[model samples]
Target: MRERRRLPRPAKLSVEGESDEFVRPMRRSWTCLARRLRAPPLTALRFLTPPSRRRQRCTPGAAMADVSERTLQLSVLVAFASGVLLGWQANRLRRRYLDWRKKRLQDKLAATQKKLDLA
Candidate 1:
């Protein structure tokens, strides 16, 4: 009989999988930093210090109101953006979950049909 040929194993498959999971957090942090770097400098500066101290010669209530107004605007913008992201993520997750469930049910139905045929 002729000798059977064998394929060579990849050198790094196991290690590559482990390293990919290990680097995931670092990649996420880098993306977060990159996003922060790309965002408007004005918003970054406003948040660097407490809002009251940044504005001069204002009464406590007025300072609070100014801070509150700015805070409200920022909160609204963040909420809207995050809401959009979350909604998209939720929709994707729902679709994936439904697809998975449908696949599983089909698999079970197929198995049941096979058993019924054998019986």
Candidate 2:
């Protein structure tokens, strides 16, 4: 099996507008090679806040109306559309393969019956 290389986290501007709140990971020259292999860009941001120390700055209703929520919804819609297309193509390919196999088996059976009749 071909091994997939892990993508290095890209330099991100802090969501809270505090540069010192989050520290970037150390630079590794080897990660440059990993990027050249066409790996997907790392979009997930790792926040430094501990579970107990973290507080919800905005109300739940406000978060739902935020720009981030719209972006997330758009991403989800694109993913769902892509998944549906892929599944349809896969179902089509499976049906074609099954049909071809059925025809081949029927032909083989007919040939065997002819040989039996002649014997």
Candidate with maximal TM-score = 2
Per-residue lDDT for 14-61 in model 1, tens only? 453376776566567656766866858676666565656465577888
Name every residue pair that clashes in candidate 1: none
Q: Per-residue error at 25 for model 2, in Å?
A: 55
Task: Give stretches of model 1 more than 4 Å off.
Answer: 1-64, 68-71
For model 2 the local lDDT of residue 3 reads: 88
- After the best TM-score superposition of candidate 1, give how far the Cα of residue 96 lies from its true spot, in angstroms: 0.7
Relative to the true structure, candidate 1 reaches a TM of: 0.42
lDDT of 2 by residue, 1-119 (tens): 99876655656534465564354333344455656776555643545564686777999888777768679989999999999999999999999999999999999999999999999
TM-score of each: 0.42, 0.44
